[model samples]
Target: MPELTMVQAVNHALRDEMRADDEVVVLGEDVGLNGGVFRCTADLFEEFGEDRVIDTPLSESGIIGAAIGMAMYGLRPVPEIQFSDFIWPAFDQITSELAKMRYRSAGQFTCPLVIRTPYGGGIRGGHYHSQSPEAYFTHTPGLVVVVPSDPYDAKGLLRSAIQSEDPVLFLEPKRIYRSPKMEVPDDDYTVEIGKAAVRREGTDFTITCYGAMVPVALEACKKAAEKGWEGEVLDLRTLLPLDTDALIDSVTKTGRMLVLQEAPKFCGYGSELCAIVAEKAIDVLEAPIKRVAGFDVPFPYTLEHVYMPHADRVLRGIEEMMDY
Candidate 1:
């Protein structure tokens, strides 16, 4: 077991999948020659060849549209949008075409595609380069949205995304792409989609978070422990088909909840969690299910530190919940 960065784990998933299945191909701007802006696809062009590792123009719509077409023709096309902010141009292709193809065609057609994009702030990517758009895809039917918190899950989940029959949105947190590494097993492994990973267990309270906020939540958990409080951290790897049972169990035991997310406050995935908690475990709650999230406004460049939910905000919410 050798530790590898998140980028390396993703690269291994793509390479292994392509080697195993001839239909697997990757296409995105600079994915061929430049190896992607973050070099997430470095050396893929040479190893997979230009045909399998194709590069396209700046049109996000065109890249996604073509991938949809390729999937319909029985190819597993993995496309990248460079950044999550730039994926809007392909909204119709993803929501209308890719999402509804199987249902609209009555199983006559299918789009087995993976759209990978780096999302969330932390690298000072500003509004254009940094934004969490998973909630958008989660709202659309027939799309699988996934976000991995670490390299091991990154590799396993990407492999699962590539092999799934339905279209998948693979959201990677670019900020941790190279900073975090783990000794992922050498053998083949595929983390099941729609599962939540419990990073730490405690009975005092449950702090459920995802993506870029996971490490922050972990830090908050450590702080809570030092102050004589116990908290559990749930890493929601899959946005859709969330592990409701795990969520319910943790909250039922702790009798308190705080949902953490990097996305904006309004209409965020956090809202859905709030509803689910209230519905399933209202009686078990000692306090309202609080949420710490980014402000509703567009991600601000200069004030991003305050815009995105921080560890302090999370702890404050937790402390309030405990007092209640």
Candidate 2:
């Protein structure tokens, strides 16, 4: 019933969950008094107080490791990594310990932890602050990777991630953290995980993307429409356990496909989508699957525009697909 930015919606979700659930606790660097570097946790510290909302040291591994421990014991912990580029320090803790808990214990225990982090380039954050590393966690066995494109999905998907019985990697696209505003319901609701939303419908082709690239894909679709190329755009709210059914269904009707991501082209989430289409929906394809993604290089500070896949670049890829 109100319009809010992605970051504001995230704050709403966190506050609502904390109020409804006593076990829900939030902790990270500068998350309490500072209210997070991006201020997504703004006012939360004052509302929830110190015990429920805590500020930890600058150790990424300690933040995640402690969250895992808290989840293992009876608390539902939501730990923020500040930035995704800094998440690698906790890779072992996430992959080896948090991800393997339920599987290793044969369901004797579960890690209901939400590892929240701001990710992606476009804010001139350069290499250290802006990077899309969702692919790494998607490859892990016992983790659910979620990326919401807009305010509504951000609130809903985050609520689902917090309530899920399994470990979740919640990557918020920092690039569009506060720009666009969309209507989000005030009442509590959860968007189902592992489902993709069809943003724009078309019959010529389909553009599959997630996170900040969702807006890029939509813009590409609009550009293509001017040329009479009606392309469907699929916003994959969840990356891991991808909604293969939605992808195949759209490709089946459109007969052309393009997968996009802000991460590097090689081994990125786009690659996985291409592979799935080739394996399951190739027969319906009118053209080879195309991938429009960030180049296989470190994100450049000066040339941030070139490092991100924008509408123009995506339109070029669509042209190539059409020509091929």
Candidate 3:
């Protein structure tokens, strides 16, 4: 086992996929030689050659649009958006063309591509580079959204995302790219997407989160345990086909839930989880389902700490729910 950062883990996945499948290709800004702005693709071009690891022009729309054509021709194209903030320009290609191509073709065509981008705050990227856009793609049918918390999940889920039959929007937490480190398995293993993991299990209360927010929730739980509160923390590794059963079960067991996230509160993934908890496990709740999320305003220039959901905020939600 080797302790790898989020960036290194993702790099491993892409390298493994490209080696395993000749049809696999990666295209994005500086992906060929510079290894991406974050170096997630560092050295991929040198190994796989320029034809496979392409350095595309600075055009998100063109990258995604061209990827769709490649997939239609039976190639698995992985396109990278330097930042989630820049993906809006290619939103049409994703939501309209790539997403519908598979269904519209009715078994005639499949656009099995992965749009990988880094998201979330804690890097002082202000509004643009710090945003979490998973909710946007999750809203659009036919697109799968994945947000992995740690190094292990990063490598595994990216492998699964690349091989997934549907077009996947893979969001890596930029903040955790270099911060958190964990032992990744030596051999190849892809974590099945759309499954939520119970990071810390307890019956007191459940705090559910994904991506970098998982660490916050776990830290809050650790603190709560010292004060005699055993909090259950669930990491929703895959945001799209959410493991609603695990969520409902955890909430039902604890009879309390506080959905924590880095994304803004308005119509975010937390909203969907909250609604699901209400609909499926309302009778099991001891109190109203609570949320600890970023403020609905744009990410601040200097108040990044205040804007993001922190350990205190998560603990506060726990206190509120347990008190109620």
Best lDDT goes to which candidate? 2
Best by TM-score: 2
lDDT of 1 by residue, 1-324 (tens): 989999899989998999999999999999998998888888989998999999887899999999999999999999999999999999999999999999999999999999999999988878898899888888888998999989999999999999999899999998789977898887789999989999999888999888889999988888888889899998989988789998898999988899999888889998998899888889999888888998889888888888878888899988898888
Supply the TM-score for candidate 3.
0.98
Per-candidate total of colliding backbone pairs = 0, 0, 0
Q: Candidate 2 versus the native: TM-score?
A: 0.99
Candidate 1 vs candidate 2: the lDDT winner is 2
Off by over 4 Å in 3: none
Model 2 bad stretches (over 4 Å): none
lDDT of 2: 0.93
TM-score for each model: 0.98, 0.99, 0.98
List of clashing residue pairs for candidate 1: none
* lDDT agreement with native, every candidate: 0.91, 0.93, 0.91
Write model 3 residue lDDT over 62-156, tens digit each, in one string. 99999999998999999999999999999999999888887898869989999999998999999888998888888988888899999999999
lDDT per residue as tens, model 2, 263-291: 99999888888888889878898888888
